[model samples]
Target chain A: MSTPATPLTDEELVLERLVALLEHVAADVLEGPVTDTGPGSLRRLGLTSVKLLEFLVAIEDEFGHVWDDDVEESVIGSLDAMAAHISAAGVAPAPTKRD
Target chain B: MHVKGIESWDLAYDGRQALHRTEDGSELYYELRGAGGPVVTLVSTIYVVSTAWRNFTGNLAGDHRLLSYDLRNQGASDGRPAEFAQHTEDLKSLLDDLGIERTYLVGTSISTLICRDFANAHPERVAGLVLVGPPFSPRGSSRRRRIAKSWLAALDAGGPRALFDLIYPLVFGDKAIAEGGSGAYLALRERFLAINSAAQLRANLREALGAGDQVERLTSIEAPTLLLSGDDDFSTTESTLDATAEIMRNAAVEIIRECGHLPYFEQPEAFQDAVARFVASVEEGTFPAPWTAPATEGKDR
Candidate 1:
């Protein structure tokens, strides 16, 4: 019998979703695979100003999070930070339609 | 930044940069360079900031007093959106504050319309006009409308970067893009992203799209005018430039080959040469004398 897979925690799930969104939005300019979730990881993954803005928009669209004009950069400084910020803000993912 | 060694053109080189408060209280960011020769005021397109004319300013500043400014809603300037008339007034205020008696205006793209309106409004203040890639019709074509709509949609969806990607091809010619290659393109993209934001670009576009046909206004400009167009510029054709020149009292058309909407960037030397020649012709009184249309031509003969 095969061992059962460990279920992902809520934070892990958010991180996974954020990575996916970054990959989708940064396909063209990404330098390498996005494995790191530490601070400045977005910049490390080769997200420039343009791609960063697109990624922010994607995050808002996916998570229903509206960024304030004066939002702290540290909140968006890394994948993990963004995930934590999203969870901390109590932003629920937008409801998806059943196919 | 993917590219290295790209020199910074953001700062004023030997000149002074300042923000002038218009009568309406909007701050207009402007740069004044050089001094002795004729004043050549550089007007920017909605997409770019005053530094976009760095090449032009560098080339002409040695001989001419260069005045380059960011209109409201442009780079390093206030984000307040204003119409063409408001922009014209701001230009007047800037000139007054600088003690500029008159200037030869060099404007590109949507700003060309601003130049036309300014020349019409303050005919005495304009010594000559260099209208680059001017839109001939006030009422744009259906195709133009479709493009504008798509641009707005792109801006709404992904911000200024998305809008830049959409317009990059349309704005530059094949020669320019091919020559610049990927590195050059990336550098330009970085600069554009640094200067522009979605909300600001959206406001500027709205004002640009609402611009009226200034063809009638062209007739009122009596200053020596050069309607400059890039041969590869799809936005405005040579025929359109010729027709626009016909409407003015003293106007001529100059086409710079292998260039697109922005000639100074693509073919700087050629653009500089053309502008220099025009200015020389005007100063030397060698420019073509104003042509008078035959009275019978407009009437049903």
Candidate 2:
């Protein structure tokens, strides 16, 4: 008998979506394919200001979340951090299709 | 050129600032200052406001009627996602409402496109034209389009502060950045962030970026034109400005050294002097002379 696969939790879903969005928006800026999605991984991605903004916008579009002007730096330090912030804020994935 | 009998009316409107509602029901904030000379309407760029023209107004107001205003979707103006041609129409309505028959138009950056369209549409009403940092060159439009996309994305991501941080280096020259220092830069950033919301900027940028090619329309502008460019302007260079001026029947190039995209902000005195001299020349009917290469061009080298 085959074991059933476990469904992803809300936090896991957010992280999955975030990684996809980041990869799509930051493909040009990123040196290689993303191999890490752990905490503080974003800092190692070497994103310039323009690429960072693009990633932020993509996150907003994908997660239906708006970042506060004074949002803590740590909240965007990595894919895990962003997923955690979005989940804590009770944000859901937007129904709109990603470009 | 003699001052029209509109002096009394101009004086009454001088120092008067108010909102003028267009036929489309959008309210535009305009301020009239200085009187007794030809009206010089300062067209604000997508991000700039009337208040940002304080340097230009203070310098030229003594001899020029200065009219500065925020276009729709900018500053205190009300409207969003307006069509490109709507701004041209708004200019017409504003001039008509103010009873101004003819005027000199000074437009910077994206607003230069607006001024060009207005001049082409109403050549009789344009006494002179000053296009500063016009981004109309086909050679530069693609690069500008890419930068514009980055700006829009920045605004959507972190509002005006993010956008400012991204564009600060491109908008201001090296000299201005070095001289202004971090404190001044921070202060300017605060002021910019406080101006308009992200939604407003998005609307303006969409309309500006979606605008069609206006290169062919340059030949239609018959007013005595002065194409101003900052030496370090990345969006449009001095050679581009020279080429643009060559397309027009009556146009000249004036490059301000040590300045970037915004000469009026970075080098006000130089900007003012160039404009004043050009306006004076146009008034005296002494400009737009036939083009000629220097007789000693090869010998000088």
Candidate 3:
């Protein structure tokens, strides 16, 4: 769901998009409740390493920006961190593929 | 007991090799042997099929109804693209087809991962767990990914023979390779070569490496578990078993000396003794938790 001409900065927009993407990608595990916050560790929410990898790949495929191999694991540690990484990498939103 | 070639020995038991169809139209071949006893099902290692457990089944079949099966796209089973969930589903379907209410599970290598997954998802169906030389992803995600990539790259570069050659030494004990008077090593090599194929290897590799982390779910497993490893094995060391057992409520670790990854093959007597003793203890309701018993007291090393 896209907001029309919302008064949000580019970084804010990227954060919003990432939060939506993560919630969408991990709906199976994270659907019951918002156990962890935007800055909290996703591992506590039961996002396994395999699921994390799949989430990263989905992010890459949707944004058309390859995740750098050297990127620290902390980048995906939380929604805020992931959004910051996306902003720093200058990734733009592309058409999402329904996996 | 000098057998010439593996062909001469009749590996098949009565009521052997039947296919059960899955919802996706894939047929999985399973063998049922012995009867009127506690049920035990063998989960095959990634590299070999049901026949790999023929001798092992012989050790347990007299007192326990034994079941063994070939994983999908391997051995006599029909080919389907491999996925982690498919293995669990195929196993669930096989157990249903055989009318087995609950069973003790013996899982080797990658199949051990499947066993844990199946148990976590359907704890009521699993009576006990026996894990042998199972692989687990290490600490880091990238490192784990790299390990999987390196394995696939080796397979893609030189195909199945390369994969076989790389794994053979690690799986068999160095002592066995150097001093087992019999030609078991060569025979095993021949079997590996005969079984190797591009599609089969690729599918098995995918299944082996694609399994998700079950470490967190181990605490929920209500079944008593026997964690086994070879003393000389480079993979899945005793420390690994200890870490795994710490989470399990009723778990014990057993280490077989002078063997490698495949303790059941290299040291069948020791393997059988450990299994028999464990099963007996479980049946008699005397199996001790790891906290109470000496670490190495379960069976003679």
Candidate 4:
């Protein structure tokens, strides 16, 4: 018997969704919509680290990914960088089913 | 060591303090004791310094190589930016500096998140986890916001002194308060207040609340785990720990009686017993995998 392989999500589509997510989180914290300068823009806006952590959580929720040890500070540095990182990293693999 | 009283002398006498430098150039103060066996790093409660572990360290140190450290911006550790993530990194660096490959993590209060996160991020480096009063889940955002607003209002209305007074009951159990009296509780209260680190603690608290939910990710944890929460612990209750245990592959839960959040200090004998059993199981390779561990059968010790 043959098993069906999981379909891969398009990278651009993933990036588009992530950008939208970041934009929403930024607006929530900044109290207004922000330009797509990426997460680096967050630092300029004087975003607190607590808010930054919330942003990361939002990103994880959006991409279905958790921040691993390899995740550098720069991964969330800007919108474009984060989007690219998410696109390249892709959605975190669904945990394998256990008995 | 600055030994002030008999209590201070009891704590300072056992372990030698050292500064573990991180790549960020911040130095974390830690004290290590014990001998040839599994390494156990005790992450102190945010409310107290490393000495808070003094009650049980003597017992723990005899069988396991135990290490306890002050979180950055608390105790003897140098002040720098206090981010929850940075605290985890500091722990990683602390373990590395000590040349410890893998060890058991014993964390209390908010530091429980540190142990879990470290285990999640570096599973190979964590042999097992003992989380006492881990904030497995926090109140909803609106509720948290309301509570925070009220707290801030109180802070502005009164001051740190008043705020600390208000939160004292939540920190210590009725039994502890009754035993220690207003005086012992006051002495313990004075320790945190005297440090003038309210702002530091506030920042850490905010980070912890905003650190996001880890419920979905608990299945990723592979290490043998033991969770402890007090019967009187209002924050992280038995129900919360029960929910937490359901997700882990291997976990055991114990609710300590006549204690609140800080069991290590509140009930050291009971705390030591739980930890000693867990550590021994891990060392002997007899710890059941999370999948095999009984899900709903945690004992109340």
lDDT of 4: 0.65
Q: What is the C-alpha lDDT of each candidate?
A: 0.72, 0.74, 0.68, 0.65
TM-score for chain A, candidates 1 onward in order: 0.81, 0.88, 0.75, 0.61
TM-score of candidate 1 on Cα atoms, chains taken together: 0.69
- Pairs that collide in candidate 1 are B138-B213
lDDT of 1: 0.72
- Expressed as tens digits, the lDDT of each residue in B184-259 for candidate 4 is 4333433444443666555555565555454655667898889887788756777878777877888878887777
Q: How high is the DockQ of candidate 1?
A: 0.03
lDDT of 1 by residue, A1-99 (tens): 999999986677888888877777777756666889998676455444445556665777888877653344455567888888887888776653312
Candidate 3 lDDT by residue in tens digits, B238-266: 88788777777888888887788887766
Candidate 2 true-interface contact recovery:
0.00
TM-score per candidate? 0.69, 0.69, 0.67, 0.65
Better candidate by DockQ, 2 or 3: 2
The 10 consecutive residues of candidate 2 chain B with the worst lDDT sum are B1-10
The C-alpha stretches of model 1 lying farther than 4 A from their native spots are A1-99, B1-16, B138-146, B289-301
Clashes of 3: 0
Q: Model 4 in CAPRI terms: which quality?
A: incorrect
Judged by whole-model lDDT over C-alpha atoms, candidate 3 comes out at: 0.68
Q: Which stretches of candidate 3 lie over 4 Å from their true place?
A: A1-99, B1-16, B137-147, B180-185, B290-301
lDDT, candidate 3, at B203: 80
Give DockQ per model, in order. 0.03, 0.01, 0.01, 0.01
Write model 1 residue lDDT over B1-301, tens digit each, in one string: 1112122223222235588988777788888887568888999876657866775456677788888898887776784677757888888989999999899999898788789888988999998999887765534344444666788889999787678788888788777676554434544565575567676788888877776664578887888998887778878887877777777788987777777888776666566666776777788888855422223321111
